[model samples]
Target: MKISPKARMNRLFTNGGCLDVAIDHGVCNEPSFMVGLEDMPRVVDSLIRAKPDAIQMAYGQADLLQSRPEKDKPALVMRLDMGNPYNATRHRTMWSMLQNADEPIIGALEMDAACVVVNLFMLPDEPEMFRQCVENISRVRADCHRYGMPLMIEPLVMLSNEIRGGYQVDGDADKIVTLVRLAAEMGADIIKADPTANPEDFHRVVEAARVPVLVRGGGKEDLKTVLMKSAALMAHGAKGMVYGRNIYQHANPGAVVRALMSMIHDGADGEAAWQVYNRG
Candidate 1:
C-alpha cells in the first residue's frame, strides 16, 4: 500500500513522535471508560493542543471531531467497526457491526479521514468469522482505495489472559506476521499490532510485514516500561506506536505524549525519553 502525502505526514509525525490518542473505546465495549462521551470535548481539545500525529475513533467520534474547529488539531483515522455485542456476553467468535461493509466506507468519506482501521480477531471459537472478516476487509479496503483513503488493519490474535476484569491477549509474533501478510495481500496501507513478546521474534514479524507496522497500546505498565518496549520495537525497525490507554490513562497525558514523541521522532534514548514519564 502506497502511503499518501497525508499518510507520509502521518509517518513523519508519529514515527517522529509516538502516535497518540485513540478514542475508539466506546466501540470496544468499554462501558465505563475513564474517558466517556462527556469527556470527549475536553480530551479532544487537550489532545489537539498537545498535537498527536493522529486520533483514532469510531465514525461517530470522528464526525464529532470534524465538527470542531481545526485550529491545531491532528490528523484523524476512523475505526470503521464495533465488535459484536456477543463479545461482551459470551466472549465468543463474534462479528463486528460493520460486517456489511458499505456503512464504513460512507462513514470514512463523511468524516473526511485519511484512513480507516479494521481489526481482524482470530479466536478459538470462530475460525470462519476470521475468513469472512478477511474477505470483507478486502472489499472494504478496495472501496477505501476508490476514495483515496487507505485502510489500516490491526490483526488481533488474543492470548486469553485476564487483566483486571477484561480479557487481554499476548502477542504471537508468527500470528501477527501472517495477519500482516494477509492484510497486505488484501490491500492494507498500514497495520497496528502488538510486538511478539520475544525481541528476536518481534523483529522477524516486523521484517516479514514489509509494510509499516505500529504497536498497539493495551497494558497498564508504567511509563518507563512503555518507553522501553516502544524503543525496542523501533530499534527492530517497527514504524511507530499507535497508543491510547497509555496516554489517556496516565495522570499526565501531555508529559507522556511528549516523552513518546522524543523517542519516536527525535531518536532520544530510552533513559532520556523516560524523563517525560518521570516528570509526569
Candidate 2:
C-alpha cells in the first residue's frame, strides 16, 4: 500500500553508513536499574541529541518519538517481539518471547514506522526448529510485502551455556555465515547478525547474505571496546551497527551516540571517536 520501507532504509543510512540506536529492550526485560528504558520519552530524548540515523524500539514508544519537536529526527524501527533476560537465563535464548503481533505492526505503520523487525533462533543440529523459524518469517514476509514494509530478521545462532553470559554468541563463523544466508534467502530485507568475532569471518557473513548485514551490540562492554569492535566490523564490510546499551547506558548518552555515529559514518577510529566523546 505504501513504499515506506525504501524510504525508511534511506532515513536510516547516509553517505557513510547507518548508526541505528536500539532501545527496544524494555519490551522483554522491562525497566530495571540496568536498562533504564521505562520512561520512553526521556530515553528517546537522550539518544536524539546524538543524532543517530534511526532508533529501533518497541511500537509502544511510537508516540514519544513522534512528539519530539525536531522534525528532522531519526526514523522509527518497530520491534515486534519481547523477551526477558531473567527468563532468558532459563531458556538460554533471547527470542523466548517471539510472537506474531498483527495489531502492533498496524499501529507502527500508522505511526510512520520505517520498518518492522523480528528475531528468529536457529540452533545447530535442530532441523525441526530451523523449519519452525523459517515458517514464522514466511508468514511475516507476506504481510510486510502486502503492506510495503521492510522486514529485518535477526537469525541468531544456537544458544547454549557456551558463552560466558547467557547470550547467543555461537563463536562459529560458519554457523553465522550459514544463518545469514538462510535469513536472506528466507526473505529478510535486512539482517542484524551476531559478529563471527573476526572481521574476515564476519566479512564472509556479509558476503554470504544477499541483504545488507549490520553488527549487533552484544554485551555491555566499555565504549572504547565497543567502538574498536565496531570499526573492525565496518572494515570487514558491515553496513553499520544496531547497538543498545553501548549507546544509551553510558554516562553521557549523547556523547556516546555521537562517538558511535562518527566512527560508523565518518570512518573515525575508536580512539578518535572516544576523544570526540570526551570533548562533548
Candidate 3:
C-alpha cells in the first residue's frame, strides 16, 4: 500500500508545525560534525527517545533510526545530495547528487522516508555551483511529483570566505528572501531557510516563500539563545525549525529537544523553555 505525499507530509508535522532534528551533517564529510555522533547507534537511540517530529539523515544512516521497533518514531527525511562547501580548511565549492540521484524517490521509498531534502545554494561568485544546485532541484522536483513524495528544499546564501574559520551563513534579508522565493518557485513542498540577521526581517522570508518555512539552526548556541530564537522565529510566521548541532551537541540532547518542542508546540515562552532545559 503506497502512501500519498500529503499523508506522509502530515506525519512530519504535529499541530501544524514540526521540530526536525538534522543528523545528516556527517555526509558533508566534516570531522567537527562527528563529535557527538561518534556512537551513531546511541545517538539515534537517544533521539528516538526525544521523539522529535522528524529525523533528517543520509540514506546510509537512515536505518539506524528507522529500523527501530518502536511504534512511535520520528519520520525519516532522507538527504539526497552532498556538497563540499562545509570544508573549513579549504573553501572549495562543489555539490553533487547522491548515488540514487537518478531515482531518488525509489531509494527514499525503500528506506520508508516520509520526505526527501536537497540543497539549493546561492554562493558568492559561484555561478556554476548555483547552476548545479538549480538543476538538482529541478530533477528532484519532477520525481517527487511522479512518486508523491514530499520535497524539502534548503536554500542557503553563503559567503565562502574564511569567516570564523569556515564558510559563513549570509543572513542578509534580501539575499535570503530571493533564494527562498526561488526555492518555492522550483516546487519545494517545504523550505528550510536560515533566519535573517535581523529577527524582525525574517517575516519577509516567510512572506516570500509562500510555503511552510522551517528555520535552520545554523550553529550551536547557548540554551537561552536557542530557545529565544525559536520563539521569535515562530512568532515571525515560521512553521518550525530544523536544528542540528544545537540539539545533538548539547550536554543533554533530549532535554534541548523537549524544550524546543515546548516552545514550538505548547506556546512556551523562552523563560519557560529554559526551565525545561535546566530540568534535564
Candidate 4:
C-alpha cells in the first residue's frame, strides 16, 4: 500500500478536475500519425494553456516530450498497451503487440510520468481473450504499484454501428460497474470508464466503484454536447475526463479545451463554459 492513501489520492485527484488528452491512438491504430504529429505542437500548446491536470501520450511520444522544459508542461501519463484500429476487434486478448511491463516502467522512470494507463475491454466473441487481458493488466498493475507508480485501467464496453468510430465501450451502468470492479480488483490504482448518458445512472457507477473513476470521452458530437456531457460526469463525482478526437479534432481545439477546463477545474456550469469558449 502507499504510505498515505490520502496524499496519494490528492496527488492523483487534480481536485476532481482533470483534462487527459489521449494521443496514444498513433501507436495503437493510426498509421498516418504524422498527421496527428503535425497538429500536436499546436494542440499541446493549447492544452497547456487550458491547464489540464494531466496529458496522456503514447510511450513513443515520451521521447519528444523529454526535450521540453517541465515548468510549462502538464503532468504526463504514458500509455503502455495498444491495438490496431484496423483489427476491428475489441482489445480482449493478451498479445505480444501490447507493451511489456518493463517498457512502461522504464519509460516512466525516463519520462518522469505521474502514471501509466492500460485497457481491458470485453468483446462479443472473446471471453477467453478478456480473461487473458485481465490477467496481463493485473500483473502490470502490481508491478507499477510495487514501484510507487500510479496505474489507471480503462474498461470499455464496445460500441455499435451508429457510432462506428467510437472508442469507448457502449453499455449500461450496471455493465460498466462490473467492468470497473474487475479492473479495481485486478489492482488498478484508478479506473477510467464510460459515463452513462443519464446522470443518475452515471452516479450509481461512481458510487459502486472501488477506485477513482475518470470518464473516458467518445461518441462524436458537437463541441457543446461534448462539453455538457463532460460537465455532467464531473458533477456526478467523476475524477476527470480522458478524451481524444473530441478535443484534438475540433475546429478550435484551444477554445474547446478552455471550455472543458472551466467546468472541470473551475466549477463553471456548462453554459458558463460555453461562454468561455465563445469569448476565446
The top-ranked prediction according to TM-score is: 3
Off by over 4 Å in 4: 1-12, 31-39, 85-97, 101-104, 160-168
TM per prediction: 0.86, 0.88, 0.96, 0.86
Ranking, TM-score, top scorer first: 3, 2, 1, 4
The lDDT of model 1 is: 0.70
Candidate 4, residues 1-280, lDDT tens digits: the string is 5432243345445665567777676765544343444666666666666666677887667655556665756778788776543243334333423576545467765777777888786654556657667766866666676677788888876654246643445657777887887777787777788877576677777766766788887644688887777778777888778877777766776777778877877898888999999998
**Which residue pairs of candidate 1 clash?**
16-265, 159-169
Question: lDDT: which is higher, 1 or 3?
Answer: 3
Greater TM-score among 1 and 3 belongs to 3
Q: Compared with the true structure, what per-residue lDDT tens digits does model 3 show for residues 112-195? A: 898999988787777777898888888888888888899999998987665655557998999999999999899888999998
lDDT of all predictions:
0.70, 0.74, 0.87, 0.69
Positional deviation of residue 161's Cα in model 4 after best superposition, in angstroms:
6.8
Write down the lDDT that model 2 would get. 0.74
lDDT, residue 60, candidate 3: 84
Instruction: Using lDDT, give the best candidate's number.
Output: 3
Candidate 1 lDDT over 236-273, as tens digits, reads: 87777888878877777878878877777788778889
The total of clashing pairs for model 1 equals: 2
Which portions of model 1 show Cα errors greater than 4 Å?
Answer: 1-20, 32-38, 85-89, 161-166
The alpha-carbon lDDT assigned to residue 240 of candidate 4 equals 75
In model 2, where is the ten-residue run with the lowest total lDDT?
A: 85-94
